[model samples]
Target: MEPIKKAYGYVTRTHKGRPQVLVFQHPILEAGIQIPKGTVEEGESPEAAVVREMIEETGLTEWGKPVFIADDRWKADDGSIHHRHFYRLDQKDVPDQWQHAPSGGGEEEGLQFTLFWISSPGDIPLARGHGDYLPDVLEERPEDGLGCLEPSEDVKQVYLIEEGVERIIGETREQISFEEGGTVLVREQTLTSEEIGDRRTVTRLMASTNRPLTVEDSGGGGMRAVYAGDHVIIERDGGEKRVPLHHLPVDTFSVELLLRTLPLEGTYALSFHAFNVLKGEEQLIEIHADEQPDGSFKAKVRFGAMIQWYWVNTETRELLKQSSDPAPGLKMEFRR
Candidate 1:
């Protein structure tokens, strides 16, 4: 029995606004079944081999980073078992250019490939003989309890919006702070609120100096103003009557300290933990910046109806830090 080797590939494409998944396709000896897989070469590193195999099959060249997902072992037809390491490749866009030309590597004669769009992990049909490892691979990472590891320090920033105003807040290394509202120049404008009970109420607020501010009512309750910058925004709401930008009573202490400091760009995980305060609930926050971008970074966050802040560099669109208090029962913890 010959020991079968391992390999890897990703289900990817250049289509925008789609999630990518990793997969490999190979013809099985029996009939009608093709195995998508990650293959391991004799001398190449597992990571490098997957990249090479992906390029050969998909003709894509812009794989950004590979995250190790899991590993599996299975018995082959020849009475031998092989262990294959798997990874999920993170990429925003597939490259436009790809070459079908093989770089002249091992086992080149027996390879064939294609790309797939996996809507979910369940879409991938598993081989009957292989033990189920997809569950472990697709398991969501714990949002809390994950300690900062890679780049050591991290900064989380958020933008809270109400009416036509936006306030930036930051959380770094467990310390929460606020950016100076005075330094954030805004253009003054007036707009009439939607007609309410025979009264057309009007309100005045500041708009972003760099970009147009979008104004919309926060449902029927209040107003939400959003300023879309390169990668950040300033928002304000009149209904909350909190005056987040010009004056934030809860965040006043850290305004001076935050404005004086410059935040570095990096990969960070921001965790918002809600604690019950006397009047209501407050947030205990933490930020982990493990990787840095040259000038800008992007992150997608979901909130449970709580206000958040973002500290964005005026020139680079890079997110410096974000801070927020979770709403009632929505608290998160991360573990690494």
Candidate 2:
């Protein structure tokens, strides 16, 4: 069916060793926290709309070029179908931070918009369904959300894993290496003992080619899965098998990586091996991903009578927190 056209931009910058994204809170509208976006004008391309919207809303003179990421179609409140297009722009030479009032855009022409940056990839707020396709567009971007360290530097980050009781029990150190040809290597290992308990879970993941945003390889334990050119090959349990990449939006890797490749309103059937923890259970799950107003993505995973919610950072693709309500396990968070 034909749908209305709209375009949105995700502007990003790295300031003071911390990554951030540009967002604004609409003064009058219930739009909440949002990235810069607007309607596509007559005879205007979606790419052009993104550039215009960023300048109109944020008043940024140099936002670089906008890269088209993904698109989605949905019915809005007014019963109009909206075909939303999403793009990403990484801005350089931006001020540490600033605020601005819209210069023009008619309705918001003079309205005060405090243009600001939020912690990259972490959840911020976005109004409407404007944020649905964040994961799909930003998942393969290692620089946006995944923290990094210098090539010669060893430790990138240190995180503390706490149980529901909130006691300081275990710690994990993450190391990242960027090899030639765009392949990323991320390694994380932790130690916990009698005083420690086995409450903490650690995971290792990697992403795809610079363009098209695919998951090259991601899994835990001794298992390693790779997305070869035309198909996906899996190696586990002392054996390897190849699976066809016949779907439009492939969800073959870990749930965390798969979330980044899906549009805001996209849905995919996650298979048994898609989850590192559930691989041996022979479970097939469905995943529905959406962007919250606060800029974080909330992914709902369901299989039969069981369901789980994972809150992930849009920039870093990190699973900030997770919970299974009315089920066993306390709400778990990754704290630094």
Candidate 3:
């Protein structure tokens, strides 16, 4: 089915250690408060359309990076297909209350919207379920440490150690060591069925930097890798090759390293290697996080068709559980 292309931005900010979302209501229309969203123009990308909508609706010129959250095609009242792309952005400078007369020549050109900040966007009255993803976005954000955590020199830092056993057509033991701003290490030993009868392998990754370094030691075969600027340098079978970073998924091992380096607040772009090796390309993964009611934080990582959601504890900042798309995907939980 053919679908109309549309884009929207869920803009947010932090005031007094709490994350607040931006919602607006029209002066005349008795509709639910909605976000900045609109249709994509000819030859324009969804990413570009979202930013343009945000500026037109809110009159705000500065914002953090935008993370693409959800996109799908749904049927409208006319039975027409509408393909929508949603993104989340964080801005810290917007006032608590303001009025904006949409500046673009669009459906909302002359419409004036009264904007307000809400700590819990779910609690507010919205128009046509426009804020439906508030719960999901809020659930994904980290509760403590503002947003992404930064290394603190004054406070005493603690490391979290977790161990678990996982089965994926086979059984394997996993151990993860996470430090606030230090190196994160993940080690795994696996035995799985493949073309070569039974395969046993031990893999390790040092994901301390934006560029992750990985090494695998097999009984006979070994592989080594390093992520440089915009490319991944891999060594295997005594041969080396450089692959663009966008083609790889960065959260292959875990999200601990990504969390350590994320900006405290605002939109940001990140890169990671895919959990599984295929053909990798360098691309920017837009991401956002928010605190939950239970004091835990959640993060959303997007890499094209691959989406990773992480639930982390508030005290230890350790991963609690992870869910992802794609069959045979990585699903894990941390037990006390």
Most accurate candidate by lDDT: 3
Q: Write the per-residue lDDT of candidate 2 for residues 1-336, one digit (tens) a residue.
A: 477888888887767865566777778767587888888988999988889888887877776667655554545788886777777788888765567787655787668877677763447746775555444443444453322322221221222333555554444433435432223334333434344343222233333422222232222334544433224445676776655443223332244445544444433344432322223222456777677888877888875457777776656556666555553554433344
lDDT of 1 by residue, 44-156 (tens): 77777777766665566777655543333444566566666554565555544322434435654455443345434467564442223333234343231111111122333
Candidate 2 TM-score, true structure as reference: 0.44
Give the Cα-based TM-score of candidate 1 against the true structure: 0.34
**Per the 3 Å backbone cut-off, how many clashing residue pairs does candidate 2 have?**
22
Model 1: residues >4 Å from true position, as ranges?
1-5, 11-18, 22-39, 95-113, 127-140, 144-336
Tell me which of candidates 1 and 3 scores higher on TM-score.
3
* lDDT: worst 10-residue window of model 1: 203-212
Clashes of each: 47, 22, 25
Q: What's the C-alpha lDDT at position 330 in model 1?
A: 36
Instruction: For each candidate in turn, give its C-alpha RMSD to the true structure in angstroms.
Output: 20.7, 18.1, 16.3
**Global Cα lDDT for candidate 2:** 0.55
